[model samples]
Target: MSAPSDAKHPPPLEHAASWYAASANAAPARPALSADVSCDVCVVGAGFTGLSSALHLAEKGLDVVVLEAARVGYGASGRNGGQIVNSYSRDMDVIEDKYGAETARALGDMAFEGNRIIRERIASYDIECDLRERNLFAACNARQLQGLKAHQALWRRYGHDQLELLEGKAYRREIGSDRYTGALVDHSGGHLHPLNLVLGEAAAFESLGGKIFEHSPVVSLVHGQTVTVKTADGRVHADRVVMAGNAYMSGVMPALEGKSMPCGTQIIATEPLGEDLARTLLPNDIAVEDCNYLLDYYRLTRDNRLIYGGGVNYGNAGPANIEAVIRPKMLKTFPQLKDVRVDYAWSGNFLMTLNRLPQFGVINDNVYYAQGYSGHGVTCTHLAGRLISEVMTGRDERFDAFAGLPHLPFPGGRLLRVPLSAMGAWYYETRDKLGI
Candidate 1:
């Protein structure tokens, strides 16, 4: 199948105009690729996966170079919900059911590793990204509450004990909203300023002697004993190549085209709600995501703005007005915010695999890739980076565990995958509405 058209997936030159961009810390723009270069490893994409992989590899004293099509964190890494959600989009129990006990055990051990890595990076590197330490999975009804209870138990079996179940008035104490029937709090899972965190990681990688080049999109890649990656004006010949570009990869490699579909999700940031109101909206300042299949995830920014996100476009065409798409959902969670003004609105895409599990493997024994985090990327991407680094360094057990998981292409291939996904999502949304 042909790759998605350039008109539909244009090259990104800068960060999206969002609250994160406005509050981003200043950094010098590194020059793009102007001459041929050779490195021990060539990484494509500068988001969480690429930066983390580069940092790990550089710390091991390997020569590494990262090429970004746009600015650092230019893709979903900078435009995500910022929630440090632990584990895969599909729960561990589901993984165990489908893949068996041993597979689930291996994945479960690394489930919370990403969260730990994030915290370690923040403290060790002094990344000031407004890190918080609480995330709540809110249930819309009693049935969903039961699911959360089962979820807590399942996670506990996996050695995750930092969880608390709350209901009735107790739930209101954590979240001031009455829309949720109950909540499962995971103290280990939290939120952060995603863009700043990624930028800080990039800086850390550079400090470890890594090289990064922005506006150096990979035009073509030839895999062999030594992979060659070409751009408009320059090329990279490396012992290994890592494709970390998720949805924004834009068909740089035809092999990954049908493996995942680019789906757009949007977020809106409300104007400062004042300290008193902000505290009332989120009493403990915990991040939240509902139990619905097509869920809403939100959290309060350090500056007291409500960063609410929801709604997905499987067709990859973003809504004309992001505010219009997200504002109502925000108001539904907090009707008192009817008069609050929206300060920023933006959309970004995430690569969605048919099974909603991340895909990791090596191609031609020299080119490696990790993508399709589904919607749980904030944490999983970090885990992916660590795993990829391990594989590159010859410690391949953990990486092989994940790489062995089966990933199927979306039904109907590239042409009809989007509409098929939309139809499936609509069916689940209906089930969510009926509380089925």
Candidate 2:
């Protein structure tokens, strides 16, 4: 494997060549914005957050237009591990300790709401993204296993009672490996084809009269009573604007630049393991993530390919060879797959914040934004959309709960933030190895 480097960033205006993209449901090319358009709301970025917000707003009878830098699900929303992990990057216990019980209670109440929203969309719109149930959190050591126990209790306190604990080798029934000391299973947590999910949502949005312009990257935002979102070839004027660009919104909004950083992660899919061999790797067909700060996550795709991913590349740099970086991690988890050939390897970026919580608030009162999911975008992005839509519709209580949480910039600023975060990750990784 090549040493990590900071010189690379994902090319704009296209989806990375990934297994998700290859197997994705057929999606038509949406025309780029070629002329000025007016709408009640113009959403920047057509990933999960943008599409979810657009669909919700359209359901509320608002005219919405969405602009995308590339195709739908082109960013992390399309290429993530695809596990529907519940809650935020930093869990509720951290929010409670740092923020307060009231703030935590409000945030916790809606932690799993995103999963429900996804299911509703899939059922209501007939989105076929290979929806499956159950997500397992594996603990590589006893210390991490204790963390899972505490996590289970914490979720139970939030009225989430769908957890089941497996001690010692009991988790092997679900994970099919000896690397884990224990695991906590969430019956409601799940996985699906992320790209197809976003594409399906985009279609559902269009079905509700919402318009999307792919390949239309926002160049500037002029905010006022009426907001103007400008692209190179076209512009959009709307009563309000939603900046759901997340990691890919670079250079569009100066105000949000230093608030978060983009970090990349690698994923690889092994050639079809076949149903029998796939079952040997993940016995219960459930998605799994370990408890380390920089954790590994894997699952069996609908077609029986083993989708494995781990390792972080701060500063959004693509590794020299994604397969080289991740193949070892996968083999470490399931050494029996030593001979399996990898069919796909790719990387994607998610926005990260200093405090590991999502950043939510408005810019100049009318321009709204939700980003900095900090590696937990799968569920949180959908929640962000609901909160953004609710606030736009005049209900602000839930959204305020998140916006009230302070998001500090990295201590070292842009020049040093990447290395600083990488050092922190290394420290945590060491502790994980030592079972501290």
RMSD (CA, Å), each prediction: 3.6, 4.3
Q: Mind sharing the TM-score for model 2?
A: 0.97
| lDDT of all predictions | 0.91, 0.91
> Candidate 1 lDDT, tens digit per residue, 1-436?
6323365335548899999999998877987888999999999999999998998888889999999999999999999999998899988888999999999999999998999999999999999899998999999888899999999999999899999999766899888888988999999889999999999999999988889999788889987889999987799999999999999997677777788889999999999999999999898999999999889999999999999999789957999988988999998999999999999999999999888999999999989899999898999999988898899988999999989999887899989998888899999899888888
Least lDDT summed over 10 consecutive residues: which range in candidate 2? 2-11
Model 1 error, position 227 (Å): 0.8
Native-vs-model 2 lDDT?
0.91
Question: In model 2, where do residues sit more than 4 Å from their true spots?
Answer: 1-12
**Candidate 2 residue lDDT tens string, 165-282:** 9999989899778898999999999999999999999999999899999878888988789999998779999999999999988887866677789999999998999889999888
